[model samples]
Target: MFTLDQTLARDCAVVGDLPLCRLLLMNDSQYPWLILVPRQDGLREICQLDDDQQAKLMNESNLVSHILLQEFGAEKLNVAALGNMVPQLHLHHIARYAGDPAWPKPVWGALPPKPYSADALEERLARLQRSLAAVGSPLSFPA
Candidate 1:
């Protein structure tokens, strides 16, 4: 069965879920990012999904991409499912801009991840949860 890596489990906050994927918010304030993890256990590849589930995951990913673009004014959206380090099945959705801290470069390993201050974290989580709700996402997160 697929279980989240302990590091990821501790770092990400549950944001919401589509039919086939669970959405999570990465805790780093360095980037506005999300992770989508398919619910099917032990899935390690896109081909592991049945055709319908595959379609659902794609649809949900696209929907999230759109929201991040429109609401967050993201100049670019980086979508990836690389499992080199963390072997669990998860997709990353990172909102990027031309002037962001690591602009023109990938967010990964650009700099040390900055953990949010308590108040900052609370504010960001609330903003993100509200935005997701406005987009018809039914998920609410604890602060």
Candidate 2:
């Protein structure tokens, strides 16, 4: 019943899944960005989820944020749930550094996305998969 939006699927690589969300890694090599999309249909906002689902989403979001920060030594962790272009309830967790290209400003629309090359993408995915596997919680990596 849950299907990913075309734009999201095209732009991100499947990292894995949590109990309630599908984890995706944005292909852009600029920043370590992860997206958590709830596995539900016709859900366009976080408020649409019940209290329990909301709590689970929050937990998963925090886990991804912390992972990004700790693994990347990020100066800041930015989390947002914006569905302006794609009407799916997806939360973005981006690791930010003080000297990053989009420092002092949001990553969106600041500069063009520098997508990872084939080898780089595969390596990044493997690294993320390993990281997610170590979390050892509600987070589940696909076989």
Quick one: best TM-score, which candidate? 2
Q: Candidate 2 versus the native: TM-score?
A: 0.94
Q: State the RMSD for candidate 2.
A: 1.4
User: Pick by lDDT: which candidate is best?
Assistant: 2
Off by over 4 Å in 1: 138-143
lDDT of 1 by residue, 103-141 (tens): 898888898888878787777767777777777865633
Error of 1 at 85 (Å): 0.4
lDDT (Cα) of model 1 = 0.80
Give TM-scores for every candidate, taking all chains together and pairing residue i with residue i. 0.87, 0.94
Ten contiguous residues with the weakest lDDT in model 2? 134-143
Residue 136 displacement (Å), model 2 = 0.7
The sequence of per-residue lDDT tens digits that candidate 2 reaches over residues 82-124 is: 8898989899999998889999899999989999999999999
